[model samples]
Target: MSFINYSSREINCKIVYYGPGLCGKTTNLQYIYNKTSSEAKGKMISLATETERTLFFDFLPLSMGDIHGFKTRFHLYTVPGQVFYDASRKLILKGVDGVVFVADSQIERMEANLESLDNLRENLEEHGFDLDKLPYVVQYNKQDLPNAAPIEELKNLLNPTNVPDYPAIATTGEGVFQTLKAVAKLVLLELKKKR
Candidate 1:
């Protein structure tokens, strides 16, 4: 659930980026952190192993703008993508207001994408968040790689519900903001409904 601080007049939303190992979850956060102005973004903190794989999660706090007098601050996170980190993944989903499933675009990683996506749904369910009702988006990342799956096939497998989806190359910043903006918009709309 999102937290609204009446005193601070801030609406803090948590958005988690989830996907299989090496699917570019951290890359997406890093790209945004690098591109955003220092004033707009806070320092990105990553709990990762020495090899740089996310150990627990990656967090970046961003402030966009005021909405009806409340400052909208987004806390973006990326769960550890490795399969064995299920516990960590569940913990990170605890207060998610939105989700961006960063599916690997390579054809060989299709099964991993499916498994990770299913894990996402199951974890969210355990936390009382239904994937179908959540503010969700899908990002087909690493689209620049050779043997990337066709958009249609990817959509069929990962986004059957046809949520706002984007084809992205996170390393190049391609389509990153589009995906973020879409999910953030949905989250804000959900907040409006709650109000």
Candidate 2:
């Protein structure tokens, strides 16, 4: 559901970052916002609760490049990771062009990661979008932590479909852009296919 603004000759695509609570989805967005040049990005708006958990979603409009004559703009969003925020999550996913699932790599959060992934599938199904058909990628965040699960184990548990995945440390910005770029590339390819 990419939006083509004829007046501005810009194509706006939505890419949602989703994961369990405290899985570093917001951190990924923040890092991208901080590192992106001001001219290439629009203002980033983030809504969070007192504990710094995302209450809604973080919105960052970024200009990736141009397709034909239209400027390609990706509006990156991260759904609130809390379980109670399921309704908000569904709403934010309505017209998503791509998804980045940021899974917490710590051994203790494995269950949470699985639950969130299942929730993501269910929510996408409700919106008439199959996760299998969507442009999706996985990011194993917090890989720098000593307690992080092994990459093989994480892949076995989280990426059974073998979609593009990356190991990341969101705080220090490792693999953040790589994950973003991979998903964004998929999204752009999808767009090209549709055209």
Candidate 3:
């Protein structure tokens, strides 16, 4: 759900980046943070374990243009990708307006990707949000790796629903913004429909 602040005339929507461990969720946020102008983004807060893996989430609030009359702000977040952090993942999905599933494209990580995808669906269901109805996109990250699976194979395995997927190398910024823009557009479109 989105939160609308009438006094400030701003609409705040939450978009979560979810995937298995080391799937480059944090890297995507760091790239976006580094490239975004200071004026359009808020301070990025990241809570991590000693190993630097995100323990909870990375929050980056971005202010886009206006909708009808209210300014639209997107709060981007990344749920901890470790399987043990399922509790934390559920917490982060509490009020998500959109989701990006970052699937690791390494051929060896196929099972991990499937497990994480299933976890995403289960977690969302626990919160009463059906994955199929949500504004969602799949990002096949780490595509530059030598052992990365072919795009066709990845599509068959992770994106059978065919909901706006992208090939990405998150560390180098390839397809990063494209993925974000696609999901953000969906989020905004959903918002407009509700108005």
Candidate 4:
């Protein structure tokens, strides 16, 4: 559900970064917030629990260049990955225009990645969004870790439909922009089709 604010000449789209707990979803958003020029980004907000250890959500607003005379803006969000926060995850997914699944690359986290992906599908379905039809991409994060899983194995398990996927070390910003660029391109293209 992209919003066209004609008065502001802006097209706003929401992109959610989803994955298992500590899978670098938030890191991706943080890297982008730090690297992007101030003029191209808005405030970066992270909502944390009372203990200051629990992350509730992370939000960042980004402005891409205009398309067809309309300024394109993307609001990036990351849902809380803890199992107890499943309800919050579903809520964050509502009205999403695109999604980026950040899969932890460690071999031991494979099962977690699978479970999270399944959750994503189920939650998206609840919102009347089909995973197959949505503008989506996968990011294999923490690639620099010594125990990272082989890219081929990760691809076989996570990207069976062959969506655009990128290998990224989000902490260092490697492949971060590429992952964002691919999904944002698909999102803007979808907006054009809708128009």
Candidate 5:
């Protein structure tokens, strides 16, 4: 959901990056943080373990130019990808206006990918959202890795609904901003329809 702050004339929307453990969710956030100018963003807060695993979520607030009369602000979040953090993921997903499902494209991580995706569906259901109805996009990350599966196979397995999908090498920043812009645009358009 998006909050319209009449006082500030801003539209704030939450966009979450979700995937299995080590699937580049954090990397996606980091890339955006590094690429965005400080004037356009706020502090990025991360709650992670000593080993650097996300224990809760990484929150990044960004102002993406402007649309019409309202300034658009995106609150980017990343869920803890480990299976043990399922509860935390569900909690973070509350009020999510859009989602980026980042999938690890390495061939060896296929099982983890499927399990994580299944978990995503179940969790969304618990929140009363249909995966198809939600504004969702797919990111096939780790494309630079050796033995990565072909993009076609990843699509067939992970994207049965055929939502907008991108081949991403998130570590180097490829396709990161495009993915964000795509989801953000969808979210904003959804808001437009409501008004």
Candidate 6:
């Protein structure tokens, strides 16, 4: 969804970080929140459980360098990935202009990653959007883990479509910006098409 600030002539777009359980979606957001200059971003807010699991979502508003005079504003969100939280996931997918699918790269978690992607597709279609057509990116998160699958294997199984993909270690901030900028660029291009 977009909100036009007539006084400022700016349009804000929403981008969601979506993925499976414990896939570092929140960690990615946290890294960004920490790295961004305070003058350029808002406070990070989490609607979560006592155990730190996302109960609803986490939100952070960010600004990119001005584009064509309008300072690009992005409202980032993360959905609860627990299977029981399916309803919450569907809710957050609404009004999403772009998505970053954070995939756990460990070999053993391959099935979970695919299942989550399938769920994402189904949920998007329910909103009348096609996954292939959406402004989407893939982040093979937790790449620092030794048990993680090789990037080539992960790419073959997870991103055969060749969407812009990033190898990320979210906790240490490696590749986080690359993922952010990739999706942000795609989102802007999508908006440009609309104009």
TM-score of each: 0.98, 0.97, 0.97, 0.96, 0.98, 0.97
Q: Model 1: per-residue lDDT, tens digit, 1-195?
A: 799999999999999999999999999999999999999999999999999999999999999999889999999999999999999999999989999999999999999999999999999999999999999999999999989999999999999998999999999999999999999999999989988
lDDT tens digits, residues 40-84, model 2? 999999898888889999999999988789999999999999999
Cα lDDT, all candidates: 0.96, 0.96, 0.95, 0.93, 0.94, 0.92
Model 5 residue runs over 4 Å out of place are: none
Q: Cα lDDT of model 2 overall? A: 0.96
TM-score, candidate 3, is: 0.97
Query: Which candidate wins on lDDT?
Result: 1
Residues 1-77 of candidate 5 have per-residue lDDT tens digits of: 78999889899999999999999999999999999999999999999999999999999999998776889999999
Model 3 misplaced regions, further than 4 Å: none
TM-score of candidate 1 against the unseen true structure: 0.98
Clashing pairs in 2: none
Error of 5 at 174 (Å): 0.6
Error of 6 at 107 (Å): 0.8
State which candidate has the highest TM-score: 1
How much is the lDDT of residue 72 in candidate 5? 92
What is the C-alpha RMSD, rounded to one decimal, of candidate 6? 1.0
